[model samples]
Target: MLEELYRQVQCPVLAQLEIGVTPCALVFLDAEASGSPNLRCGDAFSYVAQAVTLNRSLLNAGLPQLTIATNAIDLVDDYLSRLDAEIRPAVFPLRPSLDLAKETRFYGAHFKLDLLEQMALTLPANRLLLLLDTDVIAQHGLDPDLLRRCHASGVGAFDISDQEFSAYGSTRVIDDLELVAGRPLRNPRWFGGECLIVSAEFVGQLVPVARACFGRYRAVIPDLNHQGDEAFISAALNILSERGQAIIDIGAYRMVGRHWSGSTHRDLRWFRGCALLHLPGCKALLGRQANRRTFSSARLWRRLVLKHELNRLVWSLRLHVQSRRRDKAIADSPEAPSQTW
Candidate 1:
């Protein structure tokens, strides 16, 4: 079943690149189509800007980078064309799986699993693969020894089991996954989808099980109750751990801070110490940081609290209206013509 997903990947540069020789970072971006109601930004270009900024940070950290993108390939190419060859990653084109897109709640969340399955098939065994969401920004180079230790442990993920948000309540994830599995799980955990550190060997084991678990979940769970990739993968990890797989909680090591500036859970002090930060609520700030070529944690907070709140409120209202208008248009539209011509 996973083999079908490989059709979306076009890795023209994979042959030229060396994979297992050193650590590599895989950043995934799926640009929402033009004129769509994008929650992250006003348009797709802002998302591309964030991705470019992220790729640069990974390159600066002395790691080879690979970017998997859909729809924004032209924009990414244009952006990388202006930069020096040293900073540009081998950007692979991944057409979004339309079926999975409709099946999942989030637009592109499950694409990571597809890419992970692809990586498992392609990359050398036990090679370190740091999968990062486009929203993540690196403040400093990651520690090599620390990364190796995490890699040695089979998998490393930021534990979000205790963190609860309205959209995705982490507390209920285990129970929900258990319901999907049709049995109770042992030592199950919930992870934020922002950053995941995995070995290619581990991925080979993980993706199959994750996909299977997700298949069961999608079949049994209601569309409204469906959680995205993180929960499904966590369920698979928990199952594997019970069978003697090592799943390390990288949150304890402060590898990455999942920071949303607009939320009450925002912790700048803790975020400062982490090498990577996932700023989901600050896409506009990410665009600004990308364009300015400077990143300041202090500036992020100031802008979010002082300026962006009102703008965000306005944007939200505008988006809501646009969505309603689109829905009404679809609902009122005439049926398609017959093919009997």
Candidate 2:
């Protein structure tokens, strides 16, 4: 059998791999109230473990400079304190915990936006801030070229999944933005908030725009669910787009709500050339694993063992062939697909 991958999720520390240099800060907000369901599930340990895992991944990805925002620092304090004394200072608070529902016009979305807005005030216009969910696990640190492309585009999200308006006729999102901006702006694309890269130039307006749109959306929608943050981000990007600003979609191989949903051979999405793995809408480590128990008990998974084994052999052979072909091409020419990483 092939050896398991060099997955950051399993081991927090990685031998630093050489990636082209790109200076940027990776920020993660892991603030969860003590009463949160994740805490109730006794999953705090895993949450802290994932945070360390992600931190180590970033360090190896040529991005050792990390800024972490969390209110539950006590939960991860042990892990954080174990790092070099000099490194502990990077962990800070996500402040002004107002009626988050009132401040950012949404619950989870605006709290992050508010914090980001404040961070942008001091961040230089030349640098880029890659704001990500604390739950995101990176097998690869990040492709420097991917980040450069995202930075060049001004603003970028992990993927663009939402079309103009989803089923709910969620005009409230746009309406709130219009009320704040005092003008109409078009929201064309839906973004995945699991991860976003913002250039200093656009941060100033993006945060305020998302805040304004969400704040008044409460009165307009009246019964809005504190669900996806992408809706708020989409509004802000729409306004930016109207004024000739652009946001790029840094597509990934696949995204799944339940982390283990695509863990088998039937889910071809897992085998693609994915850049990262994201559990965007997840609120807890236990939640990402919820599918594991069910998947393990599935009749198909049990009955199709032989078929799955054959699929694995075929997939492995294809990868081997591709690698050999690329290696041969590299021997013949300086520029080849081998540099894709």
Candidate 3:
């Protein structure tokens, strides 16, 4: 299934890149060593396989460089041998001396450490770093020209949401920027953390500082309160702001299977612009509903068109079921009052 997804998307991406130009390299920071129970091993393997296929496709398409970075040296060795040396994977080890002390489980800190390890292996000032999560899969190849345009325009981020920014206190920095730009920087949106494109220059500027900050603060700070790399990024932005550095805000990109929590329908607007779709929980849902003939794409379209009515029906059914359960519970209760409210 992973290989199939790669074949579908990677072929087109490679065909589009210029022959002489240096191609972008996709990077992932494997966090398998952290032993976090929340970490899904299957998802990690699927992601790595997809990356391997992408690397192979890009090389076949004539891209100059394709690399993978991971702290799992043995895993990297096994993967390269399995691929028959088709994909060149890079091994990055965690600093042996760095103390990773924690009172309880710290997922965010683990992620920050992983990011730092990946960043350390990046070559200086030329290549584009395509950072992605283990659960995310590319649906379509990115537009090379569009990516270049974004870099040229100094766009730091794409698909950022205001809510996420507020959650991270990034809005405070944006408000400060508004004061400098002499305009309001309102209604900023948050971007998902699944994928990001970072230029070598930006990485050079931010990665070191983020590492230093994390290293300095990791031991003393409470695990629950620490915001990890994202918060560190927010801090880096703050530092840059103080130095009069400009931040370019690129608007949202199309992302499918993300808003599935709200509704199952795909947003056409997202499809038109998004290069990737994050199917975090869709695997189970799609599998379960696969046998239902009524849940086909055509029927899904019908559901979208009549969303309100369907939602109402679902809500009514839930309410009725809840009422019956409540009544039954009350009837069985020994201390139940006779008066019905």
TM-scores of the candidates are 0.70, 0.58, 0.52
Candidates ranked, most accurate by lDDT first: 1, 2, 3
TM-score of 1: 0.70
On lDDT, the stronger of 2 and 3 is: 2
Q: Pick the candidate with the highest TM-score.
A: 1
lDDT for 235 (candidate 2)? 61
Mind giving the per-residue lDDT tens digits that candidate 2 earns over 1-341?
A: 22335443443233122223222222323334232232345444455444544454455434554566554556446566755553332565556443444233223444567556656655654456666655554444555545555566667664443322442345744454455444666554556665677766677778777777666544444444333356566666777778887666666423212132222423533422343445422335323432232222123223234344555666677767978987787778966445454
The digit string of per-residue lDDT tens for model 1 on 117-174 reads 6655555654666777666777667755456566666688887777743445644665
Candidate 3 TM-score, true structure as reference: 0.52
Instruction: Check candidate 1 and list the clashing pairs.
Output: none
Lowest lDDT 10-residue stretch of candidate 3: 19-28
Q: Cα RMSD for candidate 3? A: 11.8
With candidate 2 superimposed using the best TM-score fit, by how many Å does residue 75's alpha carbon deviate from the native?
6.0
RMSD of 1: 13.9
**C-alpha displacement of 72 in model 3, angstroms?**
1.9
Clashes of each: 0, 1, 11
lDDT at position 311, candidate 2: 57
lDDT of candidate model 2 versus the reference = 0.49
